[model samples]
Target: MGAPPQPRAPSRRVKLFSAWFWLYLVASLTVFWFAVVIPWLVITPFDRRRRFSHWYAYTWANHLHAVSPFWTIVVEHAERMRADQAYVLVCNHQSSGDILTMFSLRKQFRWVAKRGLFALPFLGWMMAMAGYVGIKRGDKRSRERMMAKCRRQLELGNTIAMFPEGTRSTTRHMRPFKRGAFVLACESNKPVLPVIMVGTHETLPRDSWVFTLERKIYPVLRVLEPIEPAAHDHDPERLADAVCERMTAAIEQLRAEIEARGGLEVRPPQ
Candidate 1:
């Protein structure tokens, strides 16, 4: 019998096209920011600037996802978000795309990002202008300043989003949770809202700019019940542990649900 035909490798031309597509999209968005977002932000009142910037960011993220043919995003329990209450939002960090997935919540919140991220040309400038908090790792003084800024935002009834894992996990398993977000929640007396994200790592792994092609990337995010500050007696360590446990469990459940639905296969971090 004749040898069976071998499966063909993905075409190099297609890979190049995909990479170029992302580069073009990024350039287009940067132009849109300078041409539209920046002009409006400059004219907006200081008091409303943060909210306006967040809205613009949310619009940009959604627009990017909408234009990407290989991506699909699903969010559950988003209605659990209470419009009247501000929370310390914490989530697992898997990929850079997690930021856009979080924006799918469409909630108003300032991000606690690395100081380096805030130094990027246009995006970093936008983040600073939008009043997002930045922390310099290993610098005690910077940490103090970041926390104080976060506390002020909480006092003003603004939510703050943080990735308690600190950095993207290299493997499917989550890295150790950091105490900063929990401490901020305790000090600010804001409830801790835990969100679980799955499938983002597969879509866009760490340190890579190219999108995985020819596959449907279904990223799922679930908003779990918020943990009231009183539940942990204002203890940051206990609060952190409790939140981490709940999020771990929730991720497992989400994985099982995805498996049952015959959607994209979610792999553990390496």
Candidate 2:
């Protein structure tokens, strides 16, 4: 064979003006935030220990995914997640959809996200009301505050989820791991749960506002075996490296599985 045929580009018209797509997103945000999130915020105290808001947010997120006709999320080994155990859940970031796909885990965790995400309109407001930690990158004071908040959350028997890459990978490749998440794990003596998310970039690539509806996107969320903090002897750098290696391997395995299936439509086992 001389050359393989390349994939066709998505229709620009459809990307820009998909009536159902836009309507679904708009209605999801407006109705859910106004009808559910706002009411919960009003009824609950900001510092309440019971995470009624997070549960509502999780349900809303699942509903949003369920309404998307072109997308399906399959989470594997989700039963490995324990309700009683607190963990530093570290995941590789690929696209904005990674955040949405994570809710499939259905595990209660406080997200450690960038400060800017905390400034968005409805989403950010909901995150704040749900008590997620926000850090201003490169700001020492902000980092300190974030770490303090994470430790406190752990003390309260809550898991903390962080994107160890610190930013989305434009090419869906693994980037250098950041130490914040590992440090939190080592300091708190919690297990580091490595979660690999694949196909998110295909669903919605970085810097692209439009959803790629050319093909059905089946995103996979795999929760690998957790690494105990004691194994790293409280060294965040080493723990980060180990977790990164495991995640990279897990991504490769996911890709191989997809290839074996000969398509991206294979749903991971329930």
The candidate that wins on TM-score is: 2
133, model 1: CA deviation in Å?
A: 1.0
lDDT of 1 by residue, 1-270 (tens): 222122244357547756876787668668757865656656666555277777777887787778776776777888777878899999998887899889888888899999998878778877876779999999999999999999888887889999999998777667899899988888888899999998887676676665554565678888999998789899999999999899988988887777787756442232
Looking at candidate 1, the ten consecutive residues that score lowest on lDDT are: 1-10
Overall local distance difference test of candidate 1: 0.80
Clashing pairs in 1: 171-269, 171-270, 172-268, 172-269, 172-270
Q: Pick the candidate with the highest lDDT.
A: 2
How much does candidate 1 score in TM-score?
Answer: 0.89
Candidate 2 residue spans exceeding 4 A from truth = 1-8, 12-23, 37-47
Cα error, candidate 2, residue 77 (Å):
0.4
Q: For each candidate, what is the lDDT?
A: 0.80, 0.82
